[model samples]
Target: MYVAVKGGEKAIDNAHAWLAEERRGDTDVDELSIAQIREQLSLAVNRVMAEGSLYDPDLAALAIKQARGDLIEAIFLIRAYRTTLPRFGYSNPVDTGTMRCDRRISATFKDAPGGQVLGPTFDYTHRLLDFKLAADGDAPHAPVAAPRQEDTPHITEFLKGEDIIQDEVFSDDTPGDLTREPMAFPSNRPLRLQSLTRGDEGFVLGMAYSTQRGYARNHAFVGELRIGKVSVEMDIPELGFAIDIGEVELTECETVNQFQGSKTEPPQFTRGYGLVFGQSERKSIAMALVDRALRWEELGEDNLGAPAQDEEFVLSHADNIQATGFLEHIKLPHYVDFLSELELVRKLRREAEARMAPKEAAE
Candidate 1:
């Protein structure tokens, strides 16, 4: 029998106090402001917002500051806060076709319709550390071209014209929210995409890499990757039309994989889709690969039993918050459980000794 531990409140209070002190290291140095975090660490803020499933940059920055720059913890804070807000109405899905694209590129074709506009990408940049950035030196801005307002055509569209790509029929059915409803087995594409979009970036990246290393290898080529702002519209029954709610930055990736055919269907290239909040190209690309791996059943491909191919496994472990909680719980006191295990081990050892002693005496 174990007695309950007391004085948890006092201990917690002291721990919080120490944490606060530690968060504000060096009183002489200026503390990091939320604005500074938002402006300077925008990528971190974007990642937190993407994983947290919230679009507010300000709240994400605050969460980052509160979490002491831990992205996962910041995501948790944002997710916790998001649950308190009242839902007005669901916004209509933004049309990426009409997106005001700042960057658009394709690997399938050297020359595409939009002509491979490489906007603000680190693709060609050398991985050398710029020591000049350490010191506060003003850098010259790259020359900007006039803004292109024309809608850039999707690379898949060109393939579709030649009937080289498999047709994706659009559905009017509403997508299920994983946050609101319990996930059932054999989830659909929408649910799988949702899970991947909010999944831990590193975990998703690793899973994608596994596929490239011959674990359910689906030869994926970047069909198109576009980063831009899309207007979100909300349908209003009173107004008799949808009104523009807001605009948000999004990164959309479509991967074209190897051709697949059957007795009934002709050979055509299949596709994997990924769309994420903010300018997260790497996450979007990884998401596309994982998405394709998870679509084995629907695409009539063999279930290779890969980690990325397992829907239940992917969905179950995607959440960092839940993973962190269970992992960290091991640090908590388990005195009674440990004692029970110790007793069992001792009993087993004693039983073995008694049995061995009789054998030795007989010998």
Candidate 2:
């Protein structure tokens, strides 16, 4: 009734050998260095770090090289490696208010306290292919104004003063980590935000797009987007004070959505928050939109059953690694299962034919 295939060990070894050769194509060409990937392919490294939930660029770059430039695979490698490392202690929440901003912009206000600084953005670039880049790939640097010394206050804070935006309630509750525990239904805002931050950028983007296309539409305006480095500190029990551990680059986005009013609450602009590692404006913006969409019930807005509004659906399918693993697992051996199904179908057909033959003879 069943058969087991043997010699898989030898076949697997040969396949791995072939894969190693393919990964290092053209032995004459110099292999890509991890440093080159860290510096030159910085965005790729940033993405792997963001999705992997690890901040080490060097390790992220090494993972990229080992995965042969497959970013999702690189993220998977980093995540797998991260679990083996021993946990020392959790760092205190980094303060974005004191961030040393390299790029800050507010769409809500044309001119705020700290003027808009469009640093290293492709927003204004024309979609023209420069032939020069293909040859030498060197470009002249443009002059920039001196960096602002004063700390730029959040644009939402300005609206908060006038009670125009709904105030965010402060909480000391420890958020649940999905990685440590299984995800449950009806997740809170903190868990939702965590899922979004580590979620696949393209998947989050599509869900956010659905909200904009009249499926639980929340008219969102870019309140502010900031990219900078924030100092990380940890409280050492022996030292009696928090000490700076290091600094990490982060992108924070705040979106102002349509005003909501109820019998218990006054009409005020609602907010959606997005924070991610490195300069990921598009992902951050998309994240904010989806975050706000998921808060329909909390904001007293009717849930129109949109994909973005469904927390269970979004959070469950957001991780590309999980999605890919299950999807690609279908390629694995299923001969036994197929044989069982075949036997059942044949038995059912034989029984049906036996019954039909008796009826035909009587006719």
Instruction: State which candidate has the highest TM-score.
Output: 1
- Please give each candidate's TM-score: 0.95, 0.94
What does the lDDT read for residue 352 in candidate 2? 97
- For candidate 1, list the clashing residue pairs, or say none: none
Candidate models: Cα lDDT each: 0.89, 0.89
The list of candidate 2 runs beyond 4 A from truth reads: 1-6, 137-139, 351-363
Error of 1 at 319 (Å): 1.3
Regions more than 4 Å wrong, model 1: 1-4, 137-139
Candidate 2 TM-score over all chains jointly? 0.94
lDDT computed for candidate 2:
0.89
Mind giving the per-residue lDDT tens digits that candidate 2 earns over 187-300? 899899989998999999999899899998999999999999999999898999999989999999999988667655678899999999988888899999999999888877
